[model samples]
Target: MSLAHLVPAAVALVLSAAPAMAQEAPRWSFAIHGGAGVIERESLTAEQDAAYRAALKQALDAGSAVLASGGAALDAVQAAIQVMEDDPLFNAGRGAVFTAAGRNELDAAVMNGTDLTAGAVAGLTTTRHPIAAARAVMERSPHVMLIGQGADSFAASVGLEQVDPSFFFTERRWQGLERALRQQNLPIPERPAGAPGPQAANDLPAPPLNERKFGTVGAVALDAQGRLAAGTSTGGMTAKRWGRVGDVPVIGAGTYASNRDGCAVSATGDGEYYIRASVARDICSRIHAGASGQIAGQAEVDDALSLGGSGGVIVMDLQGQPAFAMTTSGMYRGAVSSSEPARVAIYGDEVLRP
Candidate 1:
């Protein structure tokens, strides 16, 4: 049957035999993140605070509008991240992190559920939109991941703007790098205090974990055509080495979407644990096998932390249910749907305030 004729038949079938599916099909799917954990009240100016809330609303609105207008879920996901990437407050695009060598090496990834296709880039110094480059990598290249100058070169070949590395510099990140360097130099005791438990890597100088938390912004969407899509973007861990790569650009690590499974998840923080846990895709698989969105989202995160990982996640299930979780005190998050306008969450010290 033609699409126009098929629409009414499909609607009738859904209404009569699968009303739940009908309900889900027309609804909007959107979620956002500013950052996770311990964003002190004193740390943000009123203007900055307002910007966070505004960005969340805009991202949610854009995604919803796209889904409402029959746009692809992938388009909605990318559109939401583009908004965040343009905003300087978030650690993406314009305000991305500076490396240990004092350069910007951004990372981003995207996935399409219809066919399980995905793309990513790591250690990119400049490209107008790293997410777009990631999509290009997914669609145009035979490979799934690209790194360093090669990634940048691929992006340039695809017509993405290659800004100077200096464009990524910002005063806040420069100071953050300086602080991380100092923390690296602090001496460790010569030997174990008591027993020979695995001593911390004193000589390697791991970056402090408490610096501005490594929060990534992402979206999981159900488009008008009922397809699923997801994307994630980040500046990577603060004070990271120039060539350091994180889970943000890793498919199973930071982002995953599976239409048949009915859920998509995006993760941020402690890339090593995310990879070990397969955090994002695990959540989707759990939900597909009958776990609640809330339980599936939290369980994987908890599992990662049990193995010493710390980070937050945003998740959405086939039923249009949404959940956000983190081991941290709070994970800067928000959600919106046809049933509701917008709701944002943040931490007020030990308590979570919505």
Candidate 2:
């Protein structure tokens, strides 16, 4: 029911799969990404790296709980994104980056590989959980995409939580805006009306410039029924202008999944390049063409890099195999499956014992 109870249930699931149980019981696979970019090892303090790892593990645990109960891959994807959205560590809902206008505009998308149903929203301002709104659009509305004020309105009409725009503010993101504006030699816009006053970062210090990376959050999963799902959410690039929309809500580009293709993928990096490369769909298509999930992930990353784009992808196959590929020096990532426990890593050099 509650997020706090999720991990324990997942543990019970693993326990139930012991020798006492039938070997035919299905196993699940899941993986999540915070973002991708030039995250060099020396850039992060031990504390910041640990904080990111913890947030990722918590998200993985939430998704594991859903899949543990044989839930749809779509539900697990949504569940994982919701946790990251609420956390201010990654740039999705609460920790979203600010636009040139000094406001948070969020974007999110979700797809059901089982039926090819998908929903997405961009330029959202007041919806507390953009991932939930994306799901609501897929399950309730006739349209596949919604944007700006109409999107928030649609979310509210569906009984999703609506919060004051100020609720999304965090000192860390504000500091990021300052850095981006200064770099571009542009004057900072006045903080929007109703925005919270600047506050101390004693609790969670704003990541230093090099440590910030890209901050988009995403997940891909394989559920017990052999279906796939993928979801991605982000606040867009810091100091973004003219309502710039990224690949996150554009389907196939940043997030794509398909049972028929035998893979689901979520990607993060430079949105424009990913859009051009069609990173997520390209990975799934390669997998469909009989490449192993690992090879597909690497090939997609290589393709994106060839286009002068940087980022990463989480690829999970129908058989519950996981592969992660990134052109960036580091990517915040983690995974859990029926055969292995949850493990998280931030820097690219950290070897994960999968």
Candidate 3:
């Protein structure tokens, strides 16, 4: 062959190789939440509410950047949760709710989809951020779930920062607990004090009237290496009984990820129902079994609500598709993808509306 012909052929081969290499390299995508639900209009002033949503956006942007820069999915998930914890708006880290006993206890979990490896902490009182502790459990501990004092010790051993227990207390959350307790003590009038038919009863404790929803925090991300990961953090249920554990620290119930399948994070309402439903992993399995991510996720949410439960989720499938669905009137959700910016909402309808 002539020298010029050989040169052109070599150049063409090199150009073809470049696209192949690009295709093989890792790409990233991610979505996150402070929590999903209906926030009462009264609880958040326009300005305070805007600040909360903005914090969520900042976290999403930070995590997305990490994933885009070739960071691991685990890193993205934890980073996002950390921001939520710091914000004191959503019930995860620093702003976690007070227990029935008037103490703040936090829980968190993280999982790597590539291996179905998971780690979690429950009833942690001193860890500054439970998500970081959860990751440390995954990376350093021989066990998958740790609790209470032991979880704190493990976090310290692994170089995670510890703060005073008071560091987690928020005046509003403490007052909320007081309100819930006061409602529990109200007496019902037997005859409605004037007029009534059968006479209604105030048997159950007053329902939580907080503007913010069950503000658990979580993230799912596809890393530059194409691995999937998910993490969840929570203050647990408002006015939760002492030692009461919810879905937040449980693997499949609250948070689940399988790189071989997909990644999911669930904010379980009626934790009992979510535990029964195994909501998080079920959604991912449906997607893995050939359902569209949106279809599978929405179906699961509907199923949960149909059973008289309510909550929502944010997820990223193995194909890097993102989906959000809620069983309640709304789910506070946001995402950063090829689609749009990471915005926040008190109502899912507002966020999802066209």
Candidate 4:
């Protein structure tokens, strides 16, 4: 063959491979939320605000690092959430709020967009990382949801890290529980100095309907393979009773992903409202209907607000576009993408998008 003919053919082959090369390159993005609610500007000291921002930046870095390393979106989401779960500032694993019964009960959910498979755990008391347990449930168990002792046992069977229940205890969470009990005029249950026991609930105040509802932490990501995933973890509602499970562990309500539709979502807020509204799934559905991630996310958040639900959401599309919308005054959020530097914001005033 002539050299000229060979060059033309080679050029065509290189052009054909360009798209695949782009797809294979490390092009990914991640977004995470600590929670969302009425965070009054004057309420936070400068040091406190800085601390929250630092924590959020750390989470963003953790997730972005995974994606940059060509890891799966699911792994990125879990890695991001693990950072928040370990921090005493967010309401996930280590910082989970106490239930009305004076115990920390954690819930978490993880979903893979590529396969539409999901796993969740609720009322978890001893798992070191509830998000890991939720991942295990998705990967190892036939069940989509596991609760209480069963979930703990499954976590154990999988050899997920285990910790004493006290490992979840935080003084701030205990104070929040005490305040909630006081509001209800219920006597705080007394226990031996170091014994873990449920607080007596003659009448637990209806889950302390307030800003505390925004303590859940979640993350969503799109990885180099064009796959998407989402995960959410929460210390249920502060002062919740009767084994109440929130939207954090509910696939459609708190977390949803769809590689086919090209979007993933993670929500934090009033769990009941999120459940009734199917917030996360609804966002993905809107994206499927051709709306941008921001539009779909804001629309669902507005709908939830109109119904008296307060909270926020972080949405990421296959294109690495992120949309953060909150009905409340503030949402603890951060994002990182291949095209942009990491960004973290707490109050609405701090957010700057260009």
Candidate 5:
């Protein structure tokens, strides 16, 4: 063969190998949040701060390990959130706050970006892992959400593990509830208030209530196939009453994922404001409209703050870019990507690099 023929063969060989190299080096990333609120450095003890950092790093490692091993984004998100759910440090799953009646009711949701399908469970009292039940609702049941006894029933029928309600009890959450009730000057209820009929044993506090700690947990990820997924879980606000449900189980409010838009988001904050703003979906929409992940996230959060909402969000784009923004004092957040080292931050001053 002449030199010209040899040159053409070499170029063809290089072209054939390029796609394989790209496929093997898939860009993936993961991010998670324990919650967002008035987390002040002066308020937290060194021991408490260390514990939270360690837990955040552990969750980041769990999810990133899944992505590093070529797992699906949905799996990575679920895995990371499950860790937070199981940890008593966050206001989800095992550490859920108590209702006015001092009972634990949990809520969770999960979304798949590939199809935009979602599942959620709300007001669950006995399910072991509400996030897993949410996934079951997405994968097995035909419904997008299940609540209260119905949700618990569906979770049991689906073979999800059930635990005694005591499993969710934690001293810190109990104290929070007590403090909220004291602040409102309302007596602790002997039982959860029933549907409106007659006055309850204790009068419910009026609206314009004091701010309570919102400890919702969430995770978002972009996987090897460039797919996105998001999940969120919470025990709702301390001293929540009347079987209240939050954005944690509301699609597009607390959780959103869109491969088409190249974004996935999970939010933690005031559930009502988040739902009103459609914060998670709005972030994805902004990103689709050509804003970078950081810009989109911060913009949506700014809007929420304008409406008197307080909280934080963690977002991941298809390009493996991650951003976390909050209107509150701080957010318990962390992230990891194929191109960057793991990072965790609590205060606004602790900036995370891309």
Candidate 6:
């Protein structure tokens, strides 16, 4: 064949390959929150700020590794949350706040969007990783939620890690508990016997009220296979009493995902108000009803704000896009996607990319 004829044939061949190349690209994406509330620059020292950012980055890396390998969205979300849950920097597991009874009662939920199956555990005091316990509930039990002693029992039955409640102790959280109870004119309960005794003065006596008002850790992810999953873990409110439960263990409240809706949402903040607004489910619902994820996130959070809720939500769509909305001054949040680098920001004025 002549050189001109060969060139035309090659051009057509390259054009045909373009579609296949595009299809081969991974569509994975992920986002996480270490909680959302009135965080101020003045509240954290330079060192403390760096530590928080590092912790968030670690969580992003954990999830990103899973998604990059074409893992299930549920696994990616769980992996990200487990990192934060083990870190004392976040308010979920190790650093969980104390209750009025001087105990750490955790709550968590996991949702598989592909089938809409979900599992949750509330007021669980011994599970080392509540997110894992939540997943166990979904996979091993017929129920959607298990709580308190029952949840703890179920978790152990499923071979989930069980720890002494003291494993959750952190001086900062203890200080926060003392301050919260003092503000309420309540007596301080004795710390658990097995927990380590207080040592240094490195802890904040009482963080700002806004910061104390809310704390949680959560994640939402879209996997390479286009599945969506979400999970949220929380220490609940400081000084909560009489077996209190929050939105974290409530599917469609603090965490919701739906493949049919093409979205997954995870929320952090004032659980009471979030439950009322149905923030997580509401955001995905609006998207299913034709609203964009960004629009849905902000609008639903606005509704929660109207009712005096202060918190934030992270939303991820099937296309590997993420959206965030918060009524509070700041949220410890971050995102990673095929098209975006891992980035985190604490303040609302910060660029949305991180």
The C-alpha RMSD of each candidate to the native structure, in angstroms, is 12.1, 7.5, 13.9, 12.0, 12.6, 11.0
Q: Which digits, one per residue and each the tens of the lDDT, describe model 6 over residues 226-306?
A: 899999998888899999888888888899999999899998877888888788888988999998677688778777757
TM-score for candidate 2, please give it: 0.90
TM-score of every model? 0.82, 0.90, 0.82, 0.87, 0.86, 0.90
Model 2: runs farther than 4 Å from truth?
1-26, 209-213
lDDT of 3 at 337: 49
lDDT preference between candidates 2 and 5, better one: 2
Off-target runs (Cα >4 Å) in candidate 4 are 1-26, 191-211, 352-354
* lDDT string, candidate 1, 175-291, tens digits: 566676678873222221221223421111212235444756788876656677889988887667637677888898888988878877777767878888889989988988898
Report the C-alpha lDDT of model 3 over 129-181, residue by residue, as the tens digit.
Answer: 89999988888978899999999999998888998776776656655666666
Model 3 whole-model lDDT (C-alpha atoms): 0.70
For candidate 6, the lDDT comes to: 0.82
TM-score of 4: 0.87
lDDT of 2 by residue, 1-354 (tens): 112222233223223322233344338888889987777667777888778888898999999999988888888889999999999988999889899788999999999998999999999999999999999999999999999999999999999999998888887888888888899898898876776677644437765544233889999998877888999999989999999998999999999989999888888888898888888899988999999777777777676757675677888887776767776667788888877788777766555432
Give the Å shift of residue 107 in candidate 5: 0.8
Off by over 4 Å in 3: 1-26, 40-44, 186-213, 338-340, 352-354
Regions more than 4 Å wrong, model 1: 1-26, 40-45, 186-209, 348-354
Model 1: lDDT of residue 94: 65
Clash list (residue pairs), candidate 1 = none
- By summed lDDT, the worst window of 10 consecutive residues in model 5 runs over 200-209
